[model samples]
Target: MFNGLSVTEHREGDDLLTAGLGLGGLQSMAPPAFADATAPTAPELRRRAIWSNWRGIADLSPGGGYGSVYGSVANVPGREFSALARLEGARYPHRVLVQVPDAFDHDRRCVVVAPASGSRGVHGAIAVAGAWGLPRGCAVAYTDKGAGTDYFDLDAGQGVSLDGRTAAATAAELAFAPDAPTGSAGVRGVAVKHAHSGDNPEADWGRHVRQAAQFALQALDEAVPQAAPFTFDNTRVIAVGISNGGGAVLRAAELEGDWLDAVVAGEPSIHAGATSLYDYATQAALLMPCALLDASLGPLPQPPHAAQSVPQWTARCASLAAAGLVEGADTATRAASALAQLRATGWTDAALRAGALSVGFDLWRAVSVTYASAYGRYGVGAHPCGFGFAALDPRMAPRAATPAERAAWWSDGSGIPPGAGVGIVDPLMAGPDAIPTDPTFPGLVCLRDLAKGNGGDALRVRAGIEELRAAPPREGLPVVVVHGRDDGLIPLALSSAPYVAMARQAGRDVRFWQVGPAQHFDAFLALPDYGARYVPLLPYVHAALDRVEAYLDGTGTLPANAVIEATPRANGQALEAANLALPR
Candidate 1:
């Protein structure tokens, strides 16, 4: 919510500001600017906490997870800045040395530092970067919890154990339970941990998940207290997160209530119960086994001569239905429709054998292995990216198949019909399956109980946001959400849809910014030295940060563009280039 700072207003022409690094400290450069006014050298820039080497950065969100290296920054005398990062932690990992103002703290009010989720033990470098840029004076503080050992899996086989969802890193296991500490003026921050693994049974996973959430909340309590010295009453805390860590912010508020004032979730994955969004018929007619070919086999395989000897795969739905695992008229019809579609779609023993054996005699065998391992019950049809129907059908060529093709593939009443719903599915599985539909796609809909479930905390976040808008201001909790238009992992539409609706419905003050051409990780991992032609990430960050400050001060308005542009740079000089637009 800090909106006081401006790149153009402060920096003179031709000066590069301190840009953050990307995954593994990958370096990129912003274009040379033509503006004016030099900041004073050694202009009494105040020093805050020190950030050392950030090891494997855990870039997590509700949708999925990735890792990165840390970027380092020292305060510059003037209001300009520079920094660098390594792409994938390669030896020389793109060291960035940039400059920014020492007074650049967001809102110049308070700085509350939060840790990346699931990064309790790992160094700061492993944590995902914050969604909004930090203002002068405000800096995130990091702690070292030793690694090489799985923190969440500590009591994996022993029994269900719980960690406090305390962001302050100072709550008692039971006391903090599941929320970020509340009532603070300084910047509010939290340390997040990944929720229970897939192996954890859905039945009794809440206790452990709550414990982890409790830890995150406790961190908030420890990091920024409400007392006089801490002055949490003065500054607003920005909730920055990715993957499961992002979910943690929502969970903490859900369980603890009124903890985190504002939040930004990346690749957010909210869970769905029992059924899926895609109907059984749709899966059969459109979701072919061949679709899994590339992700499983690296490339397509050929057919074998004695294909009958090769095994054929029926989706888990068919098997479950036959074995009485799935019952009821709706489910049975769905299953039967899918099976018939598979058979008619040429998912025969011969096709399987051929694709399996094209490479070698054991090619078919390899295919079967992939079927069970990769496309089995647990991991199938979850992400939109992996969803069989969403893939571009090469046969269709340049343009995707029209409604006619879909009609041909779709069976009347047998499959999903026209508007079957595939509820939300698993995080990694949702991308492949997420597709826009008239009445919305019928597929797996994942809905987690925020503080209790393994993931999908976004839905639970509604209550907290509502409560905040109704309540008086504890501090200026400015919230700015940035998402990539073409993020393959987690579509930007999903992230912004609920958020925008919520803001409008509640009439609350929040800002939403969408970056174009930028995919999931690409948007966050931009630097200033890659070159002029490359895209500039700082502008996006700056814009959002400025908005955050302004909103807190009640002086700024959200920008009106699908993708906000930064100062122009030549293609040759740009380090990373991508333009994203907002969804209609």
Candidate 2:
């Protein structure tokens, strides 16, 4: 569907499964069974095998715009075929569809996957889905989150039931197109966004988690309406998301385990529970009291020597307090006094933090403490704000400046200095040179936008894992989790912890795999797309699909090889092996 490129489509009957959809008959190629009960079942492993044959659809045209973005499923040549077949009530099928871009055409019955960001919405995702080599008709379609129309269109095309409670799928079917209306698509589902609410996202963690779940559920409603009804197998779903989508899935699992079966969340985050605006203010107050001392005045040391360095400067402040250069029982009191002075002029933390005064305050130090504290509460006590910033390791945390790093903070020195004292930062505070206006800085903003919109809240969502773990598994259904180590958006380390813990608690029988470093869902991030870092996962997806087919047919065993070595120290060992002594 790429505007400048073209994708070949094919249409055929369901008899193509005999040749194994171009990769050799995997239906008869069974692998050894895994001994570990905590591992994936045979059907799960097989699903991954069948999923690999889908080579993905690519749009290579130039000058294509958003209008070129295509959001439908199609077939591939020399591989598989696709068509809509309505299912009888309560009857599910194991059929699937696949595509090998280099070896097939769109009309071949296999789903044509293409990049959605490039006039190719979910086309690439569909290819990734097909690569699993599901069956002749079973195909994954791409749709817009806002529209929630995938299943609607699919129902019209195939006369399939819209009921989410039923787990029965017919023999299977697939469709493909570019720029399909957000309305109904034949036999295809859609994914929507979920969000939690209540407390301010900046201050309350629970509120954020709920918000994210809402957004994810919205996506699921649109993307996978097949599971809308209440049934055991109806919840056997899989998710592959990036950025906000990544964070949304995590929250969704908490809210609706009924449909969310497996997840590959890249750069996932939850809302922050501990790190809020007040916390930031408290840190600034404790570390850089001078900034709050006088809104009208410059830094206490005048142009606080940037060369003085963060550690040295904070050390100087601490040392000064020790020598009585400043007066107050503790850093907080001293900060409070300074804040009182600033408040007299109605100055807010946002104003000072972005002002020339912030240039003197060491931001790195404050930020490190913030990052460490937030993760610590969740049992991860390491300080990983990145070289000197926060949330660089992914897991949804945003990169932020620490007090030590704030030595470089500067203002354009143009606007009126914000008032003397205020609890939070005013998103609009900046000196004349603050950002030189332009398309970036707005005249007035909220504290949430300045600290890098929703990222902190996203990371905070991890805190909800504890709550999720405490809940009983919905109808004893197993959860499948997949992750790409090379994902820059969601660090492997961040997502690995909770997954391992969840698996450990569930006693295995669940499917958990780590493919090469993949970009959320694409094969490119994974090397060789297999076992190495950044390897493509299409093959594994095929294997997983094979397993799913077996589950539907009652003739499969989970493969040991299905577990692509994720993190070395899986289970609770990593938490126990952590350097910090946890509170029992």
Tens-digit per-residue lDDT, 1-584, candidate 2: 11111122333422222122333222223322324322333232223322322221221112110012211222343322221211222011111122323332222222212111111112223333443333343333232221111111111222111111111124232221112232332212211100111111112221222222223233333333444432323323444433333343344444443444444433333332323222343334333434334334333222344455343333434433553435576544554554554444334343343332343433323322233233222211111221111112123222332321111111000001110010112122234423331211222112112233355533453343233222222333433445444433233444543544554575644455555424332322111211122233333444454554455346864433233432211222221112211111
All candidates: TM-score: 0.38, 0.33
Superposition TM-score, candidate 2 onto the true structure: 0.33
- Model 1 clash tally? 175
lDDT of 2 at 34: 28
Q: For residues 127-232, could you state the per-residue lDDT of candidate 1 as single tens digits? A: 2332223334443321211110111111111110111011122321211111222323321111111111112111111222233222323333333344223333
RMSD values, in order shown: 19.4, 20.4
lDDT of the candidates, in the order given? 0.28, 0.29
How much is 530 displaced in model 2, in angstroms?
15
lDDT of 2 at 202: 18
Off by over 4 Å in 1: 1-72, 75-109, 115-135, 139-228, 250-262, 270-478, 493-495, 506-510, 523-542, 553-555, 560-573, 576-584
